[model samples]
Target chain A: MAEHTLVITPHKTPRSTNITKYFSLLLLTVLLIVVLFPLVVITLNSFKTEEEYFRNGPLSMPSTLSLDNVRAVWDRLDYTTKLKNSFMISLATALAGVTLSLLNAFALGIGRIKGRAFFLVFFVMAITLPHEMLAYPLYYMFKEVGLYDSRWSIVVIFAVLHSAFGTYLLASVFTAFPVELLEAAVIDGCNKLQLLVRIVIPINWPSLSVLFVFFFIWTWNEFFLPLIFLISNANQTVPLAVAMFQGQRGAAATFQSTAALLGTLPCLIFFIIFQRTLAKGIIAGSIK
Target chain B: MSYKRTRGYIGFLIPGVLAFLIIVIVPFAANIGISFTKWRGVGTPEWIGIDNYERAFDDTTFWASFQNNLQLVVAMTVIPTVLGLLLAVFLYDNITHHFGPRVASFFRAGFYIPQIMPMVVAAIVWRWIYQPDWGILNWMLNSVGLDQFSHNWLGQQDTALRAIMGMMIWFQLGYPLVIFMSALQRVDPQLYEAASIDGATWMQKVTRITVPLIRPEIYVVILTTAIHAMKTFAPVYSMTKGGPGKATVVASYFSYKNFFERPNVGYGATIATLLTGVIILLSVVFISVQTRQERLESQ
Candidate 1:
């Protein structure tokens, strides 16, 4: 069968293809520069002294690279406290959100569930409503319940807000699982919980991991909710800290660059570490 | 496969369903309810019927902001979608090459930095770059003997929204590009080869083969970008605060200020409800038209 049929076509000349390829490469290079130049300027200027920042152009290198600006930004923002709070909020949200979504997906995907379509529509509606539309009501409700300023308020809100999309993605993955495997497990008298824990989780680890990383990054970078909910300076996230820093440095030219750098560093490190998973997650979400 | 398990499903779904109801559904319904009443957070909301919506229609500031948002949607959606498709084609055609695809993917990720980074941080960096007197852009322009073109970009009413729209295009082009690249790779190579053997040029191949194959992805990208453009608040809030006489105030930012900052909860909800209605209507129209087209093609 492998050798049953054969077809051949003449290959195009390497010279023509090479010229077009080089032209595409040149265009791509120009785009890369335009996209990355702002970030490059920020990172470079973040290291320069105050006088050097003002005297030299933004794209120029400093005569002497120094850590003074970084240190100053660290102190000004009380970096340690903000970092700890952000970490706690982000980790809690990701863990709780992913777990709940997985459970929801399993129930809808594998279980002999009634009203699955209804639940799916509910989740879709949740995703469609803008976050701003829910802000005021949530604010008032949290205030009434006395959870407004607590870290748990933001964490729970973030987790709940994220669960809708997470469930949608995870459920789609679960639907692709083989039905025979689940039936075989059930024939052996394995319960739903045991089946989900023992079989489904292991089979879908890649998808789950992708969702986890995406949710972590999104929750960590979420700004508006934390800004509205977390009233105290002590509980502010990195984005809030950066916004406040920009507000304070509105008058000062030098501190703004350093502040932006300080704020972007953590997320940049996370992105570098999880670049592949992030790419997979982004593709998965967008393709559907 | 038997429908024997009744209690198990209920137990599994109860927690997630309850959470969604309390957090998402309740608030969403309450938002609609609140739009019909006047409230200032300090007193009881009095029923005002359609007064807020009526005022929103006549409000010059609201119209200006809505128009700005429509402009943003137009600018960001069309340009980036086209650019992304081109980039995706370039990458997909070079997929077998070792270094080229990697370099292209790296550029894709590089373009995504502005999107993933908090808008506040990106705005701060860009504000400095757009500074007229000591900024890099003006400096470069002057050096290239285009000094007449240099102006305070964010300070001018006429240019502020366009400047921000340009920033939005920069930030948003990556996601669509990545998605299109993946979709392009999934396109059957036989189609392109067949087209080429039929004496089709590159432009003809793209129009006759690539665009038709990627219509679904294009629809998704356009819908997502339009919705995103409608909900844009952080950039304007951080960078301009809808300044220069409300020049850059998109509807979302206007609603946000009215709701939280200015304590016009009724008015804010009215604007938000209207925006939501428009979005839903547009989505319905798009989906129905696509569904009809798909049905016709299938038949």
Candidate 2:
């Protein structure tokens, strides 16, 4: 049989197709609205003046869009400092996580070294076990070492913890790496370090970028560890600051929504920017 | 020599191993040791030998929290996995075919937006919406003449768990959807095409081809999301603080309360140890099941 003869386009009757199309579209649209509803409400309330929010309630149309709540929440929460702290922590975590993962993967994935299975299992546990199991002990250790309430502790913790996933991912990626390239480089007298710097790192840059992006956002969004460790206002990251602020009594509705909007905006912007990388990373990270 | 080259590569692992030991391994061991003791944060722990564990077993509050976590598994794991499979199939099979990939991806991105936000932010947004007097839910209820339905969602014991669970379903839906959609890409379009040529309805195609083909991704989604549900803390902490009389007290929050808030280090460590054991057990079981399935398929 000719292959072309076998390649027939599946036909659906137009009537059924039209009905299913409209039905699926309707279901998707309604679900999307429900999913986006909270975000939309928060964004709208953030723009509404306090007086209007109070007088008209949260659902009422804002008579005029205002930046007053945003400004108020920003200054009140010292959001700039929190954003800076979050950036520093996230950046450091991403850097440390990627470096550690790359090194580990190089040894395990390409080196085919001794105890690879043992190390792999160890990292898997690191990813699987809850941070709560590590929390009190870490809290005590950090306090004893004078690292408690310091941003460095969080950086160290997330870097190590989050790198489990990173190592797992990068190791698999590196395992499938072209052996011909390594052999060719070796024939050219490239040492391990030289091969890594010149061949491996440059070639695997996209995978490394995925790890970097995930570690950054995961660290940014971490709340429990930060809440436990970063006790001081000055050292707190963005999410911790906003969450801690929520615990305060008599917080106004408009201010609450404003804080939520501002707290959520940075990650939203990051997602929009790194979304393609994120989607790729999610599939890469989860499917294997 | 090649042996020397391999030895040098071993040097690459030193930093990662050292950091893992210091940061995770040591703390985890300490936490385990602490579980078998009696201490109040400051004093040296007295070796009480399973007393904390015994107490935890008897603790109604711990049991309540554990039960609540089971409910969350349904929210975070079961609901998301089911809904994600349907939505993934719909997007990949129907939307991509009918509306175009761009439209399908647009909806996918919308669903995923909440997953990218900080859990605290999502909790805060939901909390505000669930606020009693002036919140949107209440406002909408009153507007729709369903004033009787309005209540302080996060404040009432009856509504708080369900409210948080609802938020979690929304937060978790995108994870499986994205994973399954990508998994679907790996499926042979010809299978669907064959089924389509045979006049297999959409639901029939989903149940027959889409699901079995993406079984591996489905397992992954369930395992990871179940683990996520097991360790859920931030939403509970932020939204209700496991409040309205221990109604929403998840195991993580309970452990946290013992660890930090109430300062019961020993009992807290006990709770943490148990929680860790359960999570590890779940992962092991799921992984083994996946492996067995793969082996069977290969055979």
Candidate 3:
């Protein structure tokens, strides 16, 4: 944006600024390498057999690309089940979280209910509260309610928990909604529910979709609470499955990298698909 | 506008509030109550008010965990914000001025790749990279003829925390960088032109123009990252598990161990309650400071 307005610079740029510019480029290149090298190494090693890994050295390219290590690791971890579990939990949390946020924000932002400030502060504090603080008690409560070790336990906790931020974001977005539109709808006999479904939500679809993507990805990336809640192997999420392989002490090096690669692939796919939305959401999310 | 119509909106809040109460409010309150009683995983509690808090106050490990958390704040919050700011300014100011915007954005996306992966996945990758004998770090050290420095990066008390901090800084850098870069778009380019016309240096422009313009975003990033630091669990859990003789134990993992491993529910709750207090207190300070800065700016 600033580039167009930079009209006054000499046609031949000054030597000092040129030096600094290249230096910045060099620095960014180094940082990029540092940031990406581990991921590249993991991807590279995941294709190597254990024998290939031991014989050719960690840095060497494999003799031939192979899927044997990938298959072995996937089978050992039962990754298909983990993927299904993670997808179901994340999807449920996103849908429920956005719905809850819409309702709460409607009341707080548009409805201007009594004690809205208290509720706003309550939700803000909830967003800041650490997961560990809620983990133990939720664990005890879920066990008492016979929901422990159930995937739904994770879905419920995260939906409510993440909606705290969702409500906070959506409420701010809602407060800016034009009152004239609502008044016109009300005059046409639109009740509150109809107003939300027919008018407000459609108009604010961009922000709501951004919120949905965030809820989905955040729940998908979660590790701590799921580790505590989903105790059974049948119910474990993807990250938990990968984390259970933490020590992998006696296993071959190829197996660990393969686990890392598999664990990251789903989120990497989401990132590629939702990059722009995620960027916009961060901007909306940071504003007061 | 009528009282009855205003009451209608409260109906929208019932489901949200009900779920919030059950999932967050009730569990939170129960955790606080559990802090005051003596209990294990399976048994009824005995009232033991102040005993758990006292134990935390005396427990050296508890205090060390918090100290380690402060280190994480530096890694996750301070270093990231500082570096992210410089990097953002570089891409926004220098790169865009010299190269095309596409190049700058390509760099931004590359830096942000790490933030998109699950932390557990990142932790696994880094753990492998830091593996003592066969890991890349050791291999690179040997290749460079510096093999003596190639010890177990994660197995030593002296290096484990620092090693994890390095990983965190790498993991955390992209968030603030992206936020600040976007925030920079809101900055008027004319300000930079005017500063240049006045013969101001690049450092001067950054200090006087860029930093002041994006202070709010900086505050938001700091607060969020600091909270993440305080809740440092996944990385520590996967990499070190608070190992090398409690060297990398953090508040969250400490409380977690107490809860499950030790089965000391009361003491775990005490640690959690204290950690929550610290976080809330930090948040209050960030918010108040930010609001005051905004007021000052408006004035």
Interface RMSD of each: 2.4, 1.6, 1.8
Worst 10-residue lDDT window for candidate 2 chain B reads B1-10
Locate the minimum summed-lDDT window of 10 residues in model 1 chain A. Answer: A2-11
Error of 2 at A90 (Å): 0.2
Look at candidate 2 and tell me the lDDT of residue A266: 98
Give the candidates in order of DockQ, highest first: 2, 3, 1
Q: Candidate 2: where are CA atoms >4 Å away?
A: A1-12, A247-251, B1-5, B196-199
Clash list (residue pairs), candidate 2: none
| TM-score preference between candidates 1 and 3, better one | 3
Model 1 off-target regions past 4 Å?
A1-16, A247-251, B1-7, B94-100
Instruction: Report the error of model 2 at residue A178, Å.
Output: 2.4
Q: Give a tens-digit lDDT track for model 3, residues B171-283.
A: 88999999999999999989999999999988899889999999888899999999999999999999999988889999999999999999999999999999999999998
lDDT tens readout by residue for model 3, A120-206:
999988998988888888998899899999999988889999899999998888888888888888888888999899998999999
If you superpose only chain B onto the true chain B, what TM-score does each candidate give?
0.92, 0.96, 0.97
Pairs clashing within candidate 3: none
Model 2 scores a C-alpha lDDT of 0.89
Q: What is the TM-score of chain B in candidate 2?
A: 0.96
> Of the candidates numbered 1 and 2, which has the greater TM-score value?
2
Better of 1 and 2 by DockQ: 2
| RMSD value for candidate 3 | 3.6
